[model samples]
Target chain A: MLKDFFRTFSSMIELEFRRLKHDRTEIYSRAVQPILWLAVYGPIMGSIRAIPTGNIPYTDFITPGVLIQSTTFISIFYGLTIVWERESGILKKLLVTPAPRYATVIGRAMASGIRAIFQTFIIILVALIIGVKFILNPFYFVLALVIIFFSSGGFAAISILVASFMKTRERFMGIGQALTMPLFFASNALYPVTMMPKALQYFATINPMSYVVDAVRSLIISGDLTNLWLDIVAIAIFNIIMFTLASVNFKKIIE
Target chain B: MEKAVDVRDVVKIFNKNFRALDGVSLEIESGSIFALLGPNGAGKTTLMRILTTQIGPSSGHAYVFGLDTVKEGSQVRKLISYVPQEMSVWTDISGYENLLIYSKIYGIPKEERNNIINGVLESMGLHDVSNRLVKTYSGGMIRRLEIACALLVRPKILFLDEPTIGLDPSARKVVWEKLKMFKKDYGTTIFFNTHYMDEAEIYSDLIAIINRGKIVTIGTSEELKHSVGGEILHFILSENGLHEDVLRELEGIEGIKDVVVSNSDVTFVVNDAEMILPHIMTFFNKKNIFVRRVSITKPTLDDVFLKYAGTRIDVSGRLSEVTHVRRMIRRG
Candidate 1:
């Protein structure tokens, strides 16, 4: 039974990669936004000294937030493809297989995580080209990549949960649009929580995206382990909770 | 007979008002080709979905190989594959990749997936187009590709909903030949729905006619025709202005069970058409009605469907659907 899960899971990931071969535009399209912000917005905001930055360059401070933004944006639309497969009857075909239901959820969530890494690489390359530099350690970079993957997984789980209820692609897109900006701005992606109002600070404190950015920023900007443990613990807990919700809802939809 | 599928009083209600399958019950023998006949909204697809474990019955039970569909869904799913009505292929992927994806999904050993995919493609006569993206395939090739994908698992029972809905005659023939080969080679029980009356009559070992979410009748082609119990006689009057009168006289003839007149044509049913034909001719003569043409034929599956559904199986005729069919073909 366990072997079947892995086999099916790997195949689901393989299928996603094969599909990605045809969607070359997706890479450019998702990368364009973050690259623009890094080269354009980051420099403009840094020169104006618009926000508080304690000795750290504003560009460097915003780099990790932009990376998290790019990764989450790419991951959150994973459910749109699920709804597309449902329309194309691919989901029905896969549902009848011996593959376990949890494998599908994990496989698709993992695929989004994998895809988000590509976006991460793009954002990082663009950040470097634009003269944004930070402390780099191979070990910490690997650890930061893991955090990004888990963060992507958590967002994917939320997308799948939304899709289980919104089976139609159009309606799912409608909800994704309504939720994307709120989730981004409410977090510490662009502005630090200290810069937000009291009410906004409460939301940013609990937002999962904030922890992801915090962990990534600590690894890259300060190489500090001071709050690293809390970020990892919070994101891991978020992953567990969101994946459980996604699996339960996915099984219900297929059933 | 070994029953491959057994459905007992299955009911499916949508939105608490629309009854999709109303107490449908049927038993299909193993290794048999069973054709389900129904109109557009007759619930045939809904019933097939339940048997294939895609959905559950509201108030009754369905069994495949004696396993409860709702309770042992995963086990039942392992034994079946479905070809839904829509074009299910991934248009952007090559036929080879499409089969490969399913092979992996079915968990064929990684090493053997290639060999299995190649063999199925060859068997379906799709090796020539295997390298081309499915978007470039014809409607016929797409249908055959779907069958090949389903065969990757070598399922014991295959369920197809309208397996040949909008195909041209040649394409329809190709699909049927491939299906026949599959059934013969592996003893896979083939069950499908089709809009063509002749298709059901020519290919299926048994047929079930469904109407308004109920199984109206179930039997072999010959059995269904015989069940209606008579031969049909048709007479075309030569614009003699006496079609109504001739129909009246023909109805009164002894042994002529029933008569119907439409557009200068008269049709009637009789236990023995040979014995009744001479009288029908004489009545037209006595009334001096010119008989333009007359023919006698055994009851057809269309007649059987007409008897049960109160309408011709292809009541709108295939001509009217040519444009719509062309659009689906173009979509491929």
Candidate 2:
């Protein structure tokens, strides 16, 4: 049974890679957003100095946030592909297979996460070129990659969960648009959590994106492993919840 | 021996009010091609879905090879494959890649995957275009590829829902030919639903006509046409004459089973067309009704459908509405 699960999971990831290889344009296109943020938004915000980023340049502080933002955008809209697959009848084909339901959910969620990792590498390269300094520890760098992957996986699962109920692409898009900005802004992506009002800070503390930004930021930028365990635990719990919900609701779309 | 499919008292109600399949029950024999003939919104797709284990029947049981579809869905899935009504192939990938994905999902042995894919591709007449992206293929090639994907594991039962809806006549023929080959080679039981009367008549071993979520009639093509039990006589009246009055008058004639009129054309079913022809001609001659043309033919599946469902199966205008509902279901 376990072997079947792994085979299905790996097959789904391989299918995504094949599709990615055929159309590398999405990877390049996704990079444009992060580039604009780092080069344009980053500098303008860094000069303001009103956000109290502390010691590190504002651009450097927001680098991790921007990376997670790019992934968040991709992960949240990943359900659009699910909707398209449903419309095109591919989802029905896959569902009729002997593979377990969770295998499909986790497999597709991981595929989206893997796709986000590609954008991670692109953003890292752009960050280096723009003179954003890192601690350069290989261990923490790899750890950050793992965090980003599962974090994005969690967000993708949330998207799939929404897709189960939303059925139509237009309604899914409308809800996705309503969701992304709030999730991005409510987190401490652009500004410090301490700078927000107490209620907003509570929301930021609860936001999974905040944990991703915090863990990735500290690991890559400051090389601090102080809150690393806490962040990891938070993201892991978040993933467990999202994945379970998404898997449970996955079959509802067919109904 | 277990039947290929056995559905018993299956009911599927959508959104509390729309009873898509109302107490549908049937059994398909092993290695036989079964056609479910129905008009749009007649529960053909819904019944297929239930039998394939894509969705559970609301109030009853469906079994594939004696495995309960609901309780043993995965095992049933292993034994059967389904080609849905909508286009299921991934357009961005090459045809070979699409098959490769299914090959892996089906857990075909690594060493034999390529050989099997190549063989199926060749059999489906897709080998030459296997390396080409599916988006570049014509509608027929793409459909053939979809069927190839379903055949990878040599499933014991193959279910297709409207396998040739929008295809041209030649394309439809090609699909049926490939299906026939698969049935012969593998002894696979083929089950499909279609509105095309001739397709059901020619390819199916047995057919069941469904209307408004009920099976109106079920039998062999010959049996169904035989059940309608008469010869059809059609007369095209001259454009200057009135057809409705003639249609009414013809209905009053003794021994005419049914009379249907469209514009200046009148068609009636009679037990003996030869015996009725003289009397009808003499009546028309006395009334000065000009008969432009006349033809006598045996009853067709269309006539059978008309007899059971109270409507022709192939009303051209309803074709678009069928496609529209299918699209709406896809969107949902």
Candidate 3:
């Protein structure tokens, strides 16, 4: 059973990779937004010191946040593909296969994570060019990669869960837009969580994206392993819950 | 011989109120091509889904090779493949890539995968275009690619829902030809659902006529046509108009089984068109109703559906005569 699950997972990832190869322009297009944030928004906000970042420069502090933001955007909109697949009959074809339902769900969620990872590479390259300093530790970088993958995966699974109930792409898009901005703003992606109101602080603490940004920031910028366990545990728990719900509800799209 | 599929009194109700399949029961013999012929909303897809284990029947049972579809769904999935009614291939990917994904999904070993994919592509006549993106291919090629994906595992039983819908006549023929070859080569039990009377009559070894969630009749094409048991005498009357009363009068004549009138066209299902044609001509002559053209045809599956289901199977307005005949049959 485990063998079958991994095979299915790898096959699905390979399928997405083939599709991505055919459309390499998407990678280039997706990099535009994060570059804009780093080059334009980061400079303007950093010069003004609009948000406190202790000793770190504002541009460097927001670099990881920008990466998480772009990753969240890519991951959350992944459900649109599911809706399209349902419309085009591809989902039906996949569901009829002998693969277990959970395998299919996780396979697709991981595929989205890989796509987000591609975007992560672009953002980090832009961050380096813009003079954002990192601690230069290979171990911290690897941990940050793992955190980005699983956090993007959890967000993608949430998107799939929404797709299982939202049959139409238009409705899914509406919900996706409503979701992405709020999740970005409620988290500490842009401003410090301490600066937020009490109600918003509660949201920031529970928001999975905040943990993702915090983990990534600590690993890459401060090289601090403090709270790294909390960050990893929180993201892991979030992924487990989201993946379970998404897999259980995956068949509902066809119904 | 063992049955390939056995569906016993299967019932599928949707949304608590709509009964899609009231009580569908039938058995398909192993290694034979079986077809479920029905009009739209006739529950053909519903029944196929149950057998494919995509959905369980609300009540009763369905089995593929004696394995309960609901309980043994995983096992049944291992032995069968399905081509759904809609276009199911991934258009953004090349045909080879699409087949490769299915081959992996079916768990064909890595070493044998290329050979099997190549074999199916060649058989489906898609080898030349296998490297091309599917969106660039014609509708027929896309469908053939979908079938090629299904054939990757060489499944024992293959189910297709509306396998050739919305294709040109030539495209439809090409699809059926490939399907026939698959059945002959592998002895796969091919079960498909279609509303095309000609397809069901020509290709299927056994045809089941389903309407409104019920199997109206099941038999070989010849048997179903024989059960209708009459020739159709069709005539288009000349400019002289005939009243409804005169048309009804023809039904009273001996040897005339049924009379249907649509505009100036008159059709009579008769015991003997040779004997009844003379009477029809004499009656038309006496009334000064000149006949423009006349032809006698063997009762087709359309007539069989009209006889048994009390409705015409094709409602696309191509066969208006059959619809009129059905209305007359319903009235009597």
DockQ for candidate 3, please give it: 0.36
In lDDT terms, how accurate is model 2? 0.88
Error of 3 at B295 (Å): 7.8
Ranking by lDDT: 2, 3, 1
Looking at candidate 2 chain B, the ten consecutive residues that score lowest on lDDT are B323-332
Which scores better on TM-score, 1 or 2? 2
lDDT, each prediction:
0.83, 0.88, 0.88
- Per-residue alpha-carbon lDDT of candidate 2 for residues A1-255, written as tens digits (9 for 90 to 100): 998999898888888888888887887898998899999999997897878877999889889999999998899999988888877678888899888889999899888988899999999999999999998889889989999988888999999999999988899999999988878888888898888889999999889999999999999996777988999999999999999999999989787
What is the DockQ (computed on Cα atoms) for candidate 2? Answer: 0.43
lDDT of 3 at B49: 88
- TM-score per model over all chains: 0.87, 0.88, 0.87
Docking class of 2: acceptable
Candidate 3 per-residue lDDT over residues A1-255, each given as its tens digit: 998899889988898898888776776787899899899999999999878898999999989999999998898989988877776667887888898879999999888888888899889988999999988989889879988988888999999999999988789999999999999999988889999999999999999999999999999986767988999999999999999999989878788
Badly placed stretches (over 4 Å) of model 1 are: A251-255, B233-294, B312-332
**lDDT, model 2, position B181:** 95
True contacts kept of 2: 0.76
Angstrom error at residue A31, model 2: 2.0
Q: In candidate 1, residue B6 scores what lDDT?
A: 96
- In candidate 1 the C-alpha lDDT for residue B146 amounts to 89
For candidate 3, the TM-score is 0.87
